[model samples]
Target chain A: MSSVVIVGAGLGGLRAAEALRANGFTGTITVVGDEVHLPYNRPPLSKEALAGGVDVPGLEFRRKASIEDVDWRLGSAAVSSDLAERTVTLADGTTLAFDGLVVASGIRPRRLPIPGPQEGRHVLRTAADAHAVRDRLRPGTHVLIMGAGFIGCETAATARALGAEVAIVAIDEQPMVRPLGAELGAGMRRRHEEHGVRFHLGHSIDSFVGDDHVQVAVLSDGTELPADVVIEAVGSVANVEWLAGNDLDLSDGLLTDSAMQVATSSAPVVAVGDIARHPNALFGSVARRIEHWNMPTETGRRAGATLAALLAGDEPDRGPFCAMPSFWSDQYHHKLQSFGMPGIADRIELVEGSVDGPCIVEYHDASGLVGVVGVDRTQELAPYRKQLAARAG
Target chain B: MTVKVFVDMDKCQHYGQCCFEASDVFELDEDGKLQYVAEADESRRDDIESAADVCPMQAISVE
Candidate 1:
């Protein structure tokens, strides 16, 4: 009859609840989320969902039967948590005590500090955000996307697919250069340019110019571009404000041990998904925060198992959480899949296929093969990923 | 015994992630469309189930 409380009823929270049950933990489970809606798939929010191809219900991860046993606190945000009392206070002024806690609060999109009435500006993080952005992407609308990251590029692609004129203002020299390296990132930039999307690379926004809403963006190099709608895809900040007084390492995110256990908390608390910045042995035991799609499933399983063991008064098994990080993106006609951390690589070698066609690129640093990025070549990338995972262990 | 696999085409993006999990059971055609065997030997249940788990769209199900 142990009681476990999980914050953030997104993919990570939902999967952690399932894993807790699957691990034979017959405990009272409670999940709290700020959104009123149930846990849904987020990857589609920037792709098919933004393109008006899929509805909100279609993005859900589970049906009623899948999560019927858990107590769901939808639309309630956890405002604060008392470590010594093992209690969480919600925004609605309700507090819940727990024997075990899982922090999967995830991240929120970072916004630019611009003065003006914030309208016609969008950030695709939630279902509502996607809906608002999609509604504004009319046939002749002009969209100015800020940042060349995954979200920005995906939003640009979706905007173009919906017959909207898109222009990207990225601080990076080329689109996705930091993540996919120069060659593949350039290839992707070329593909987007061929599809009628404009790129203002190596540029920063000076100011957002408009009367009521953003209509034009003035660049740092003294160029003003007309924009009907502005989308900020800059980056995300970890949602770790609730655990403020816990004395945990909050340098980047909720710092966890190799097992995802809260390193500084005396209480049994673990973190998972995008908000959990722990030592990943795959990247040479580097403490990194991965914001990829597959991280929740992998980290949630580990965190759930660890918490279940601690709650059952049994010592958890000892092993470095070495889940191979992988993520995929669909832009234009290319399905880009990447495994391992490519951003840390010093050299990128083209292993198979051509840059314009389906290809696989291997990332290597001083150590060895660090990662691989492939376009529509999942089958070819499988063996390499397995090999990389083996090396990680 | 036979393992039955089901994929909701409406949800499937044809990413071929399932094909990588269970190559013998699921295959993407020349046009990158997904094609799969309706039923397979029970010995391949683990492979098929892995396919169901790795699907990003959650379109694949096994019975």
Candidate 2:
């Protein structure tokens, strides 16, 4: 019987396992994860989980009894991999051989270089991190969020919802401008401002100051703000360090073909989710790493299908795997949804409603409409997304 | 055959992602609350399953 070893028991890893069974792969499957918790949803960590509205156990993707017949190596991280030997070494120094390997280790939260005790400084990537941040979000507590990215903005909204005074500091002219464009970002900024969240845009963090925990953040403009807690939502780094010393390209993420097959491995190895950087035909075949919520599901399906076919001694459908990327964020009753690659658009227009009100924004590049962003207008997004997908094809 | 759907309201955030996946089955009312057909045609099983898969909260299940 063939054996498959999957690293990172997150959404991608778990979904791939399900797909393996769905594809009739009657083989031994082992899922290794660093976290003790079973595969849980990460999207709620910044919103409902951080606001203390949901318990950690409720975030699990499925109940333990539903996981089926898979060797689960929880709380053990993959320390290294030997591609030639088709084996993986875990942090506990256990080695496992496999006929198929799926690398879905995902990314870790990026940290700030500022000097301060790590007691109160937080980054929301895990369930424990969200609980820690939630515990500190007492009413009137001042929070200094050091990035205007999705995680930062969503956390800001949650913090404010919890009655904490939140201030966002970022170098962008407006929060989320690089991805959502200036107009939408400005609109989102206005919404946050209306909710009493402060913004210090176009400013960089100089350093964090406190004895045992961050209490004050000094900006590069020499402006000092008193903060009870500081959150570093800068971004994330792909967990590809273990793939080092191997021939695999570890420049950005694990470089993979369009089908998510590892480029350097002769063995049947594939990657999925945030750690897999592959050519996206939607963006003119540009190799990019998508860290959105839906990526793991879409890519996991593809990777699992491909690996199962290879193990079954069959030729996998090697079509370009391009699924319309969609992501949604809920903040203080406002639902923000985006479809497609908005960052690459050259022009953006408000197709429906006004900037100050709930709206649908259309993003267009030279090739025409490439993306659509809707705020509290989910029903109006479908046709635009269909058209965008058709155009991409 | 009809597919039976169950949504754990405690886990559901009513994000409306399921609505996009299975438009004929899942709908978000004007108040932004999720309403769905308890018994959907088996033809929509794929769509309903996709809805369950795309749910960020993992609150939806089909049988």
Candidate 3:
């Protein structure tokens, strides 16, 4: 009987496993993971879970009742891969052979290189990270958050919701300026201000001051703000160090074709989720890497189904996966959803609704066929998604 | 019998809701990467189809 060995039990890996079973593969499957707990969701870690409204059990993808059958090798990490031998080497000195392999090792949150006082600083990346931050959220606690990215904004919202005074200091002209562009970010800035979240735009943190009891946040311009806690949400780095000597494309992640196959024709390993970067046909050779919750499931499903067909000696007819990229942020009472990439929007054209209520904002690029961005209008996003798919062809 | 399934790693972020829809094949590693048992038996077709259906990105395709 043919056996499949998978590495990294993250969202991508789990989806592949489920896809394979759904596709009707009966071979023995072994899942090796580095985390002690089973595969869970991460989006909630920054929202409801961080706000103290939801618990870990409620956020788990696999409940206790459904974890039967299949071999789950928890707390195991894959250290190396051999393309010629078709083997995966784990950190515990075990070798596992595979007819097919899927590499789903995701990225880890970036941190400050120099170690400062580790008392109040927090970075929300996993369930453990969220739980730690939750413990620090007390009434009247002034929190200082670095970076105006999605996680940072969500943390600010969560902190404010917890009745803690929150202040965001970012280096950009506005929060989310890079990803969401300046105009939309201006809207977000106003939204945050309305919620009582203070913003120090176009500034960097000079240093952390004082010992508890509302420390001061020294800014680049010599301005000082008082805070009891600090949260950092700069960004993340892909876990591709293991493939250094292996000769795989590792610019941002393991480079693969649309099929998610790593290396050239000489090698045939599957790469999925955050650790895989490839030129998106829809985005025109953008070579993007998606680190959201929805992307992994789609990629894993395709990888799993493709692997099943290949193992069965059938011609795999899987096409390059493309979709309107969408993600949601639950901040205060407003649920912000941004669909498609709005990286090149000259201006944000409010098509329908209002930011005060559920609204839809369209971002138009030079070409003008909706280059990216459909805000708050999920149902209206269907047209743009279709347009992007058609353009991909 | 053969089927069609596609995975665009660039578009996939690796959240495993598909495992719930079809656990016979999808599994995650200790590092949260996606791993799977390909070549599933025919009896499991319904589950695999369900996973492809529920995939948020529609990154999954069945033929």
Best by DockQ: 2
| CAPRI-style docking class of model 3 based on DockQ | incorrect
Per-residue CA lDDT of model 1 for A1-393, tens digit only, reads 899999998888987887787677888999999998888888888888888654767777753234578999999899999988999999999999999999999999998886654788888899988888877888889999999999999989999999999999998988989879888999999999999999999898888788888888889898998889999999999999999888878888888887788865467998999999988887877788999877887788789888999899988755887887888888996889888888899999998988777999999999888899998876567678777887755
Over 4 Å off, model 2: A63-67, B9-15, B28-33
Q: Judged by DockQ relative to the true structure, which candidate is superior, 1 or 3?
A: 1
lDDT of 3: 0.70
Per model, kept true contacts as a fraction are 0.15, 0.35, 0.05
DockQ of each: 0.37, 0.52, 0.06
Q: For residues A9-66, could you state the per-residue lDDT of candidate 3 as single tens digits?
A: 8778887787777777778778888776677777767776787654655554542222
**Which 10 consecutive positions of candidate 3 chain A have the poorest summed lDDT?**
A59-68
Model 1 CA lDDT for position B21: 71
- After the best TM-score superposition of candidate 1, give how far the Cα of residue A135 lies from its true spot, in angstroms: 0.9
TM-score of chain A, every prediction, order shown: 0.97, 0.97, 0.89
Interface RMSD, model 3, angstroms:
11.8
Query: Residue A302: error of model 3 in Å?
Result: 1.6
Candidate with more favorable, higher lDDT: 1 or 3: 1
**For residues A1-393, what per-residue lDDT tens digits would candidate 2 score against the true structure?**
999999999999988888777777889999999998888988888887777655767788863223488999999999999888889999999999999999999999887677655667888898878877878898999998989999999999999988999999999999888778998899999999999999999998887788887778889999999889888888899999888877888889888887788866467999999999987777677788999899988888889888999999998878887787887888777888888988889999998998778899988899888788999887667678788778646
Give per-residue CA lDDT, model 2, range B1-63, as digits (tens). Answer: 999999989877777778878888998887667898899889998888889999877889898
